[model samples]
Target: MARPGPRDGALRPARRRTVELVLVLTALGAFALCLAMAGLQIDGRVPERFPLYVGVVSAAALGLHVTLRLVAPWADPLPLPLATLLNGVGLTVIWGLHHVRGTDTNEADRQLAWTVIGTVLCCAVLLVVRRPQRLQRYPYLAAAGGLVLILLPMLPVIGIEVFGARRWIGIGDFTVQPSEFASILLIVFLAAYLGLKREVLGTAARQLRLGRVKIFSLPRMRDLGPMTAAWGVAILLLVGTRDLGTSLVLFSVFLAMLYTATGRKSWVGIGLAMFSVGATAAYLMFWHVRQRVAIWLDPFGPDVYTEHGGSYQLVQGLFALADGGLFGTGFGQGRASEIFASDSDLILISIGEKLGLTGLVAVILSLLLLAERGFRIALGSRDVFTKLMLTGFAFLLAFQVFVVLGGVTRLIPLTGLTTPFLAAGGSSLIANWIGLGLWLRVSDSARRPAVLPLPTPAEHATVTMRLSGAHTRAAENGRNGEVSSNTRATPQG
Candidate 1:
C-alpha cells in the first residue's frame, strides 16, 4: 500500500483539468455566438451593457467549474454541459425578450446570477459527498425530507398560493421550489433503496403464466410497501396543493428507477396499470386534474379559459413555436413579445418560435446525445454504485426533457418542473449541475484500470504503452496475462 506519489496524484488530474478547461472555453464560445446573433437581430448594436457583463460572468463561472471539476473529474459530465446549453439558451431568449420589451438590464441578468450561485453550490456538493454509496446511510431520512419539502407550502404560516398552485416556498426576495430540491433527494433515496433491495424484490415475486408467456415474480406486493407509500404522498400533495406536475414527474421517476434496478418488464406493466388507475381516480376526484386533461386533449377547446384565462400561457407558447416555423425568426426577430410568462416553463416554446424547428430539433437531439453519453459512462464504469448513480442521473435528465417538451407540445398535461438547467429556477440550476458532477465522477472511474493490485515495476514497464491511455500493451498481451486496464485515447494535453 504505497501512497500515490505527489506527481502521480497531481499529473492525471492536471491533464483531465485541461480537458475541463477546454470544455469551459467551448461554452464561452457558444455564448459569444449567441450574443453575436442577438446583436445582429438588434440592428448590429449589441445590448452593449448586458451582453458584455453576461459574457464575463459566464466565463468566470465556467472557469470556477473547470477548477472544481479537476478536483473531482469523475463527476457527472452530461449534466454540466446540458445545463450550460439550456441556461445559455434561457439567457439568450430572455435577453431577446427584454430587447423587444425595451427593458433596461434584461431578465438574463437575474438568471446569470443564479447560474453563478448554482455552480458554486455544485462544487460544494462534490466537496461534501466523496462517494455516492454513502448516500444510502440515510435513505429513509432523505425520503422524509423530500416529503417535508413537498408539503412545506401546505402550512398556512408561510405559504403563498400563485396561479392556483402553492408550489413555491419563499425566503425573503428569493423564491425556492422546495419540491424541485426534494425531487433529487427522493431520487437518491430511491436509487439507494432499489439498488439494495433489487435481489430480494426480484426473488420474492412468484412467477406467473398468462396466455402465451410466463412472467417471473414482479416485486409488486413486496414493493407495495414503498410504492404505496409514494403513491399516498403524491395523492396527498395533489389533494392539498394540487401540484399535478410534480406528482406525475415524481411517480414516473420512481417507477422508471424500479424497472431499471430490477430489469423487469413486469414492473413496467404493473407501473402502467397503477398509473392508469391513479390517473382515472385523480381525474374523477380533482377538477384541476380534469381541467389539465381537457387542455391536453384540446388546447384550443372553447370550454377552457382563453386569452385572459388558464389557456393563455400554452396558447402564447404555441403561437411563438408556430411563428418560428423552420429556422426561427433569425434569432431575436421573432414575435414572442405577446407571450406573457414565456421565459420560465414554456421557454422551449419561445425557443421553438425563435430558433424554429431546426433549433427545437437540435435541442432535443442534444439532450438525447447527452443521455446516451451518460449511459455509456455508466456502462463502462466498474463500480456498481457509480454505475447506478450515473444511470439514475441519465434517467433524471431523459425524463425531465420528455416531461417538459411533452407539456409544451400538448402531448401531456403540463408539469411544473422547470426544464432542467434551462428554465429560470435556482434549485433546478444547482441540482442539474450536481447531477452532472456525479456522472463525471462515474465516467472518470470507468477510465481507470479495472483489475485489483498493480504489479511490480518490471511488469508495469511491459505495459507502459497501454498505461498511456491506449491499450497497446493490452493488445500485445493477447494470450498473455489478465488485462487489468481498459484504455481508450483520452486527450492528455
Candidate 2:
C-alpha cells in the first residue's frame, strides 16, 4: 500500500460562517413570525414593535456571528443558531404572556436588553480567552470565585429571598441569580482539577471484588478528598439556600466531569449513591424538600393545591399543558399567564400551552441539537482539560433541562431551575452565552488542522540514505570523525 501525499492531508475549507448566517436568518424569520402571529391573534393587527424587535435580535446575533468569524472561524455552527432560536422563542412567549395578563411590566423589553447584554458578554469572552485551556491555569481561583458567588445570596444586605428560596442578590431594583454563574465557574474548576488527577483516581485504586469478578474500582483513601469536598459543597448548598435544584445541578456536573476524566463507571455509581443519601437527608431535614416531594406525588389534591407552599403552580402548569393538546392553541392563545413564573421556571409549560405538543417537541429537539454539538466538540478535542470542560458544560445543559421539564411534567419534584436560553433571566442568559463562547473556542482548536514541520534538503538526503541502508563503512566511520565523505552522509539512529 502507498502512503498518501501532502494533498491528502490538506485541511478542508471552513464553512462555519456561512452555515451560521443561514441559521441565524432562519431563526430571525421564525421569531418575526411568532411575534406577528401573536399580534394578529390578540388584536387582529401586527405589533408595532415587530420590525424593531426583529432588527434588534438580528443585530445582536449578527454581532456574535461576526465575532466568531474573526476569532473562531472553525467553531461549531449549531450552538449559536440553536441558542438564538431558543432566546427568540422565549421572548415571544414573554411577549404573549405580558399581553395576556395586561401587565405593565414590559417583560419582553427587559428580556431584549438582557439578550443584548448576554451577546456582548459572549463576544467579550471569545476575545479575551482565545484559548480555552488557559482557564486550567487558575483552577483553585476559579473554584474560590464560584464558591463566593454561590454564597453571595446569603449575604445580609444583598441577599433576596423570594418564594422561600434564598438564591438571588438584589442591587436596588435589579435581581441576579448568583448560582447560575457559579455553576459554570465550578465546572471550569472541576474540569481542570479532574483532568490533571484522572490517572491517579482511575488507576491507583483498590478493586472491589465479588468472588472471581471485579465489581468496581475504589479510589485510594487519600484520593477521596476531592469527591468528599464536592459532596460537602452540595449538601451545604441544599442547607444554606434551601435550593435543592442548584445543589443537584452542581453535583451532577461534578459527577459528569469526574466520569469523563476517569472513564470509570464506578465514579457514576458512587456519585449517585452519595446523591441519594443527600437527597434523603434533605427530605428529612428541610420542610421545603418535603413539600416539593409532596407536590410531585399529588399536586392536584385540594389540600395540597390550596395549602401555603403547596402545588398550585405545578397543577396550573399541568392544566395549561392539557389545554394545548397536540397542535397547541396557537400563538397569543392559551391561559399560560394563569400560572405563576410562566416566563421563567415554567417557561416550557407556557410554550407547551401556546405552541402545543408539536412546537414543544421542536423546541426540545433544538436544545438536544445544541447539546449534541457540544458533545461532538468534546469528542474531537485532543486536550484532556478541553474535553472535560466541554463535556461538563454539555452535561450541565442536559441536567438543567431535564430537571426543569421533568418537574413541570411531574416526573420529579419541582425545583427552582430555569430552562437554558428559553427562560427569562439575565444571569442564566449571560452564563449560557459564556458557556457557548468557551465551547466555540475549544471546537476551533479541535477542528484546526495540525501543521507538520518540513525537513531541509541535507536532512532529507541523510534520511533517504539511512532508509536505503546505502552507507559505506567510511561514511559510518566519518560520523565519528574517523573519515570524511563527500557524496552523502547517513542519518544516525
> What lDDT tens digits, residue by residue, belong to model 2 across residues 38-62?
8898778998878878999999999
Candidate 2: misplaced stretches above 4 Å?
1-14, 307-309, 452-493
Task: Per model, state how many residue pairs clash.
Answer: 12, 1
Poorest stretch of ten by lDDT in candidate 2 = 4-13
Candidate of highest lDDT? 2
Give the runs in model 1 whose Cα sits over 4 Å from its true position.
1-19, 50-54, 74-79, 104-106, 210-212, 215-223, 450-493
> How would you encode candidate 1's per-residue C-alpha lDDT over 36-132 as one tens digit per residue?
6877787576657555656655764576566556566644344455556666777777777777777764467777777777777666666666665
Cα shift from native, residue 230, model 1 (Å): 1.9
Q: For model 2, what is the error of residue 490's alpha carbon versus the real structure, in angstroms, after optimal superposition?
A: 30
How much does candidate 2 score in TM-score? Answer: 0.90
Q: Estimate each model's TM-score.
A: 0.83, 0.90
